[model samples]
Target: MTSSTPQTLYRKIWDQHVVTTRDDGTALLWVDRHYAHEGSFHAFDQLAASGRKVRRPDLTVGVADHYVPTRDRAKGSAEPEIREMIRLLDANTAGSGIRLFGLDDPDQGIVHVVGPEQGLTQPGLLIVCGDSHTSTHGAFGCLAFGIGASEVAHVLATQTLWQKPAKTLRITVDGSLGPGVTAKDLILAIIAEVGADGAAGHVIEYAGSAITELSMEARMTVCNMSIEAGGRAGMIAPDETTIGWLKGRPAVPQGQAWDAAVAQWQTLKTDAGAEFDREVRIDGASIAPTVTWGVSPEHAEPVTGTVPDPAQAGDPGRAAAWEAALDYMGLAAGQALSDIRIDRVFIGSCTNARIEDLRSAARVLDGRTTVIPTMIVPGSSAVKRQAEDEGLDRVFTASGAEWLESGCSMCAATNGDMVPPGERCASTTNRNFRGRQGPGSRTHLMSPAMAAAAAVTGHITDVRRLGDVR
Candidate 1:
């Protein structure tokens, strides 16, 4: 493609990183960043067995999140195998000369959160990680995606990845969001409309007024869940909001270089008349505060709606899935979603554990006490400190919630933090898959404010019903 060719942000970024293309259309693309966590030990072990070293240690980063305990920092995880995984990440990153944000590091957090917080995730760059939520970095207009263990090893050794290009899908959301609605609700609604695997083999570019108007943190929340929709990755063009959020960060360019970088980033958008393989549009105003009712992210509906009846489903397959989900969740058809009581409330994850998310939850919990047990974990140590400094931790604790350390705690269910068996939880995390939090753990995914509302009421409550939460 030439300069005159109309191109999407995904196409532009993909073209820039292409090192070579095979006859079958597979391309070897240069990787600008690689992030690893405890789960990445397998990839590192592969490198060791093959007698290879990281090709670009300077561009690689290691963080301890998935296995690190949120309660005890000094002793690490209680399980021996979990402790070993954390130690291996420390040793592997150290041996490879890669920077590590370990348990004691002030910046230690989820790899996805740490990357953007440190300004290591830049626009027009190609980034990869061993975790599916690596697409979170695509909020910066980058071509970021997750790779398998073997693919992770390849990127580490060669600094490039062989990939089959994904077709572009542009999802445009117009109009302004109504009061009390959030990016999390918007994304859940999208997933529900498109189904779980609707965007398979596609890279999604979120556009239109509603997307552009979101804060950097909110955009990250939307892109973070693209994998739930079966999208290879999700991207939003970098605008003034993205650039302004990235400026003055520790790892970003400074002074003259900063100006130059911004200039280049400003061009990372879909050119006029560029055509996508598929296009989808959603009216932002129509979306209500949403939550998952069943096993998948696509099993979402507004809190005002009732549980779906399998008999009402248009297809037999869909009906069967719904029936199974309801049985597993111990829910009856036609029950009001808002009437569903929860046993716990969890407010944390790379998706909604940022400072803004904490504030939103805190706003609702300020003078109210949770009816059930509630756990609030920050996404990173930096976010933890910021929340504490702002007295958000005090709000949570005052509301009878547990204020804990930062990590991917209670999100991936890798750490000890978990919802009890057969208990339902109103959570702010991205996924609601069965057993995602723990064995027999029932999850209802919602926004932080919605989760807080659930905490106070002990049921799924529409945030808007609590009066103005804005």
Candidate 2:
């Protein structure tokens, strides 16, 4: 018998793609697209050792972002470890006849960004990547998630994966957000309220007045961190924003195919009267510019708030954890948030470095000068070129912010752009774990505007107070 309960966009897609059911209650789901990065080296190595060929070359794509140096794009060779991984991926793709977008290709960028930009990420499709932020593609109303190395190998050997269905959680944010508050702020607040593991073993469907009002880029920003919040994936129903963004993309269908694709996508939304395993509602107007002072994304607060006092924490274990984080971060309770100084500002990452993000940052930096070292790294070469063509680069340069080539530079310090020991930074990257940006480097997570404000003031300052851009 067919289920009658209202289904989330995720469940509808999952149910449609289920190929077989196992005795263990897991279903074999077909994957439409599989994205691989330098991190997929282990999977490629395993396939080679097993004398197995990639099962579906047409469905697989490879890119080099996580380990490729952003500054040295002209270099044909990378560091030894990265070089070997790149070599393996190239060889595997060639041997398997898989389509790969190499480093030299202008289309090459971060896998997550490249997939959507190329139109590979479409509504109602199952997409997987080796990197965790793959959920970014779910903004198109698709089912997307990150897979483990072993799972990567399994998918490469077979175009299907084993998985148990996850329950759905609906997060609804109503009302309009105040000025200076962005989708980043909304998600940060949700993570803080729910804790890091709140959505474990669940898929989060974001619906509400606030989410509906967000641009496609903003929706992507919120969905990108679903994994960090312990959700399998995050998705928003397809709407005009999604269609407008997908139109004319290189990989998108054209003419009659396009019309048919849109028609199918229109059916991908949640049915009326659908029921979710859990539901949550939040007021969008109450959200403020958020920043993380502790190690986890859940440990975030408003930019104007004070650091939490370990002594004031009610739970002994939590208090100890707070004390440890405070000690590691060199933060004191009762100190004004504005009093915290920052030595660096990074305005790019897989989480917040899209073209729209660059435009917002450029607006904030216009006619302003930054005292701290600030840098803006576009997510991809295409985004970089677009920013340059629009003269956004000039605005950043005028503000004393370094405009750099694309790739994951300074996001994780994988390529030598890192904060010095004991230095503090306001960054736009997703994670703020210990030593994430560099060894002993303290990172305070903020939105692009907040990062820009801190860059100009050389401290953790409130961005809303900066007034209108001239």
- The candidate maximizing TM-score is 1
Candidate 1 per-residue lDDT over residues 362-455, each given as its tens digit: 9999999999999999988999999999999899999999999888888889987888899999999988889999989999999999999999
Provide the lDDT at 393 for model 1: 89
Write the residue-wise lDDT of candidate 2 on 393-435 in tens digits: 9999998989877777788687667888888989998888889
RMSD of each: 0.8, 1.5
Using lDDT as the measure, the top candidate is 1
TM-score of each: 0.99, 0.97
After superposing candidate 1 on the true structure, give the runs of residues whose Cα lies further than 4 Å from its correct spot: none
The weakest ten consecutive residues by lDDT in model 2 span 69-78
What lDDT, from 0 to 1, does candidate 2 have? 0.87
Q: What is the lDDT of residue 240 in candidate 2?
A: 87
